[model samples]
Target: MLNIADTLHGWCRAARPFALATVVGTRGSAPLPVGTSVAVDEDGTAVGSISGGCVEGAVYELCRQVLHDRGAPQRAWFGYSDDDAFAVGLTCGGELDVLVQRVDPGTQPHLAAALDETVQGGPAAVAQVVDGPDELLGRTLCVLGDTDSAHGTLDGGPADRVVAAQAGALLRAGRTARVEVGGDADTCPERLSVLVHVHASRPRMLIFGAVDFAAALSQAGSFLGYRVTVCDARPVFATEARFPYADEVVVDWPHRYLERTEVDARTAVCVLTHDAKFDIPLLRLALGLPVGYVGAMGSRRTHDERLRLLTEAGVTEERLARLRSPIGLDLGARTPEETAISITAEIVAHTNRGTGLPLSHLSGPIHRDRALVS
Candidate 1:
């Protein structure tokens, strides 16, 4: 989805007027989600996208019309069935409801500030209803950062609060949920149909031990859209000059780094520092936490020795089981780059509950990765 705030920022900088088109609801296999947005400037330039090249042309024409009429923000719907429904229509046979709002030049600062705060605070969710009765239309509420407090509101009193609370809960789940509020549930003080959009931030993959393998693994992690961090106790190896593409390079002890940075189920930890002194403490620390993937590189003999050492160091057999001793899949990867791919594949498989079999020999959706789901 296009970042509406960026488009607005450009409009303000260029002193241009634009119309923002946002998806408010969907009935079937909609290409875009509720919060998907697009902006069209007075000069007919477009930033972002609303659909999968299905209704953009029609939306553009609507944008032009709104620009000419200087009309108030209004709700619009698009589908494939109507003969007059625009030449471009959804191929998936789904229907979409959208909101088209004219950018008010005066409110650029307020909108820009909100956008900046939201982006800086990381993945978050914001909900607004642009269509409907005068009493409930064009109302917006946003949960800034990772906190629960919201800015802006709908006119529906307790109903607005109910919707805001729902949005916050969805944001915490890191997934968008379709909710019907203001119905039989007394929780919704008023009766209204609302759509909730939750944007979850990317997960962090912090790779400890800046070795040759770390560089390759970092590249693989980037392909997976993880915020990759490469670290090592040795400054000489951990320098950015070595792994320039890494999101971050920390020249500190592995355990020390984990102590300062937050590591949760969404986080992954890799111990490539094969040395006993380095691997032992780092693995112990990582195993103690609820990190999604904790891997250390070693051979069968190496793993056995490491296990003995770890057991001596007070790590339990259950914790040792958590450590994917050999690391990566059974792909028999040899080179650094290939090994990195195998390692990343193993991580994806572990998270996705995969049997790690070739899909050509299996059935069902091959791309059943939860990372994609989230």
Candidate 2:
């Protein structure tokens, strides 16, 4: 979840040369995903991580070599082997394919610009050729998230244009994907592997209550990479000083604010107001939207009453099914901070299509999405 692009942007502005190592591919239960990266300076100072803490030492050495060589990008693989899982192999019993390359503003100005855009909250993606001829190794194409065009050179030919188009498509879809280019008969015989690293803005969380629980949840949501907004009809409670973690604080009717705001499928709507007036109207509007998560906090009796009111107000049965009443997971939470944890946990599970079960009980990938990991 480290913002490597932000770090790289600062380094580029300072005219500091660095080596960038990225996890281009993984097998089994790797600790990090394909786009995870670490930037190392000449003094071996590192920013970001390719693994949680498992393979950082080895990757750091590889980065140092890249800085020393100042040549074509190098590809290396690390994993648990039958002979030495304790040595260079990953102890997590997973395999990682890493691409190590030198990055300097003088040579790769487009990369610096792309990282700058990402750090500035503008959507962007960096597509790098991880596997290709020696001349093509480390070649890059940066696709702007706001437009279809791209910057950077990948042979300055049709293949680069095609790669830029593909990267732009992935950026528009808000996804990070690995693609093979120049494999076709008409293009080139050698297949080129490319990894597109996408940087998109954080999702939004709209909390419609300024109570104690709201304050706690605001902090939790911010930690979970949510652009949180705390809204309430009462100006006394909905103050910026009260919810310091929230991105914005507004004193307005919950339903009215939501109706006027811009919400998409990635947005999460939480109704902490238990009052019938605020709860009914907001749920009616929220349940019908295409948001990712919608939850209302209340007791069982209050939930049933809200359902009845929503039904009386003509909320569809299909939309009512989307409502998650009682707000959070069944954690038996009693305190406001605990309740906030529960709520944000449920939001994460819902967004990732997770079962909300303990890791011991599940037998699947631990990291749902590389994008979500950030």
Candidate 3:
């Protein structure tokens, strides 16, 4: 998918006018998640998507009208269940509230800068307050770098900081939140409401093995919107030709390689180097970190042997349990490609804590429609 933020930057640099539509809230089976953005240039060409094929046509038409009329920024909500919902609603039968703003150079430079930085950094989240009629209009914050400083102010003071802090935490968790400012000594919203758009680009997947399965897994991970890396001590097998889909091919020992890098709660590491010579040292290194997901691939007997070896190597039960050996959900996948799908599916399941059940069997709302990035 084209990076909407980059496209917006180009428009900004060219002094061309454009409208940005961001999904701010959702109540039902919305097609896109909060923070999903769509930027429409003067020509009506767009980048990014807010809903499926359901709402883009309407949003684009509205954007054109807004640009032509020089209209003020406003928030619009589309509910799927409305009688005429199909006319300008989410086809998924959900409701999504979008913040449509007309941006120019003087509008929110910090917001543009943050978006550009995030686009270059791959995928990150940007939070902005489009509402709070009393507080801030068009004020924004970028949250990927661990701190939440504003592009502008809803109202500066301890109250803003408190809200910013809370927004940053939610952003890191890849979620959006609507906050109300209470009565504080300095200033308060007095029942003011601000819509925070927190966008989480994608997760990073590091695979420590350049075997056949690793190549397939990299391809599979890419389909799930993961930045995949394949590393192996053997340069021959780790060659780019073997795994063209991997974003990075590293010729390095697993343990030494991970030591120099930072892995956080959003990172996933897969150890497919089944040999104890490589597996044990790598597991030792990975177990000490706070990575979101860590898994090792092997057959049942091999997994058992690895566990025994880890015990012999002084690995504790607490740390050992963290390892997802035999590395995938029980899909009984037999081929490398199928196995990769199972592994990637497990990653999604773990990230969202989703029940791996067929949708036809479920009764409640579909949690959220993840952007189908490939």
TM-score of each: 0.72, 0.84, 0.82
Counting clashing residue pairs in each candidate, in order, gives 0, 0, 1
Q: Clashes in candidate 1: how many?
A: 0
- Clashing pairs for model 1 are none
TM-score, ranked from best to worst: 2, 3, 1
- Candidate 3 residue lDDT tens string, 1-374: 12366777677667787887877678778877766778787887888888876777788877777777777767788876466656776667788888787766556665666666656763344445655652355555554466666455556656566666666766665555566654556556343455555556567799998888998999998888788889999988889899999988999998888999767777899999898899999998797788988999988999999999888988899999888889998887989898898888888888887787778998878875443111
Off by over 4 Å in 2: 14-17, 41-46, 131-137, 153-193, 369-374
Using lDDT, give the best candidate's number: 2
Model 1 lDDT, full chain set: 0.74
C-alpha lDDT of residue 344 in model 3: 86
lDDT of 1 by residue, 194-283 (tens): 555565677789898889999999988988988899989998898888887689999888888898897667687877878887888888
In candidate 3 the C-alpha lDDT for residue 118 amounts to 59
Tens-digit per-residue lDDT, 1-374, candidate 2:
12587778888888889988888888878987787888899878999977677678888988999898888788889888667665577777888898898887778888888888887888888888888888887778898766768798887767777788888777765667688888776556678887888886677999998999999999999998889999999999999999999999999999999999988778999999999999998999999887888999999999999999999999999999999888999898999999999999898888768898999998866765444211
Q: What are the C-alpha RMSDs, in order, of all predicted structures?
A: 5.0, 3.7, 4.3
